[model samples]
Target: MSETEQNGEVTAQLVDGSTPATPEALFEKLDALDIPHRTVEHPPLYTVEESRSLRGELPGGHTKNLFLRNKKGGMWLVTCLEDRAIDLKDLGERLGGYRLSFGRPERLMQYLGVIPGAVTPFSVLNDHQDAVQMVLDSALLNHDPLNFHPLDNARTTAISPKNLLKFLEAVGHYPQVISLD
Candidate 1:
């Protein structure tokens, strides 16, 4: 196994090249909840499509996540499949917001401790204030197993959809799951 793998940095523990992450802290939290997961590390990609193309034939339905905020700077989590086309305006309305836009990179780092490409539900671990409200695309919940960034951008982790819920529970955040359609 590679050094990164040995350190749990490669696979499921994938991290951002720019962020100095505490994998031990993350794993410790996961361990506390006994959440089952596996990781794969790689060079970082600028887009979710790029990440998907690079991660061919993975075991689960990989999701593209978006961290956004309204005019009020209220944080929101948007998880969806690669193929889905989201009308952000409609999404904003469905989310009960008058307006929505991409949140600032600074806020991303502040609340989630993640930069843009590194946004993942695992980032919730860093949001100690519970400042971010999660909104999971319902379609994603149907995926038996799901893939997501493990608090960083350079790696991806696959875990059961149910286990994803367990992980969220472990974080003490209950996501408001909704359907895009």
Candidate 2:
């Protein structure tokens, strides 16, 4: 079946269907959950600087997602304001010991099914093993809407902050809200 048709059928099944396996499939999951969102297709963004140029066109609280792992292999997906300063040393303490480092590209793909620039909470849908812990910056949560790449840096998806939590829960991820300030 065509991608569009598959997505349509997936939406028809709602939350009863399996997790989305592709970026397009992710949208289908969102639709199935009745969560409102806006997607803007744009040039691929690898860094915050590249994405900043499109800020005017996209309205919402933008996020930068980090995939981190400790020496013990405890993995975390941290999402915060695009401009927020994250002190890995401090965050490591909060997350419980052993200094955290960015998970390798291959590891990211294995866990989140996304490339480096595409890391987002939405990627958790691809984590069928439920191995990654999710963290949301309390500062970013104050915003009504949140924006992140939808498993692909070429597109940005915006959804209300409350809906983000709902989406995370639907995907079996329990997000920890912490102050990254």
Candidate 3:
């Protein structure tokens, strides 16, 4: 089946006139965890620079999320400041043992149930196998309210730093806060 025939239509139907499982379910989980957050919607654009441009429209700190994979196909989630210049190689080395690369779209969909241009920590909610591990840039964790996608490109979610830690804990993953610099 083509991408459009599969999730595209379903996602469009769910997102066009209504919110879908990706973001809605994530929010439900957040609510269950008693984690408070605000959602912001934007045009579907796939770059950190574009996402950063929406910062003026919001009152939250912006973050960039990377869905990466080790050479062994182990998935990793890296959430950091939107402005930081992150070299994947340097990051892989610092993170230790295994060259990092962009994860395959198939693996992304299979593991996180998220498509390209919509990677986020919220996607981790779909990772029932606990295959994806999370890493938070220390600088970003220091910020008060950080914004990220709620598993969709059309919306952004802002949550307190404490709430973020809480959400991660709720998702059953203990994120490692590291200094990206």
Highest lDDT model number = 2
Q: Which regions of candidate 2 deviate over 4 angstroms?
A: 1-20
Model 2, 103-134: lDDT tens digits are 98867776777778888999899778788999
Q: What is the C-alpha lDDT profile of model 1 across 66-164, one tens digit per residue?
A: 888887768887888867788889988888854888887767776777667878888887767778888788888788678877776778877788888
TM-score of each: 0.84, 0.87, 0.85
**The candidate that achieves the highest TM-score relative to the unseen native structure:** 2
Worst 10 residues of 2 by lDDT: 10-19
> Model 3: clashing residue pairs?
none
What is the C-alpha lDDT profile of model 3 across 14-114, one tens digit per residue?
A: 21222224688788889898888888777985888787665466765677778899867788988888787899989988888669988877677777777
Better of 1 and 2 by lDDT: 2
Model 3 clash tally, residue pairs: 0
lDDT of each: 0.75, 0.84, 0.77
Better of 2 and 3 by lDDT: 2
lDDT of 3: 0.77
Clashes of each: 6, 0, 0
Error of 2 at 87 (Å): 0.9
TM-score of 2: 0.87
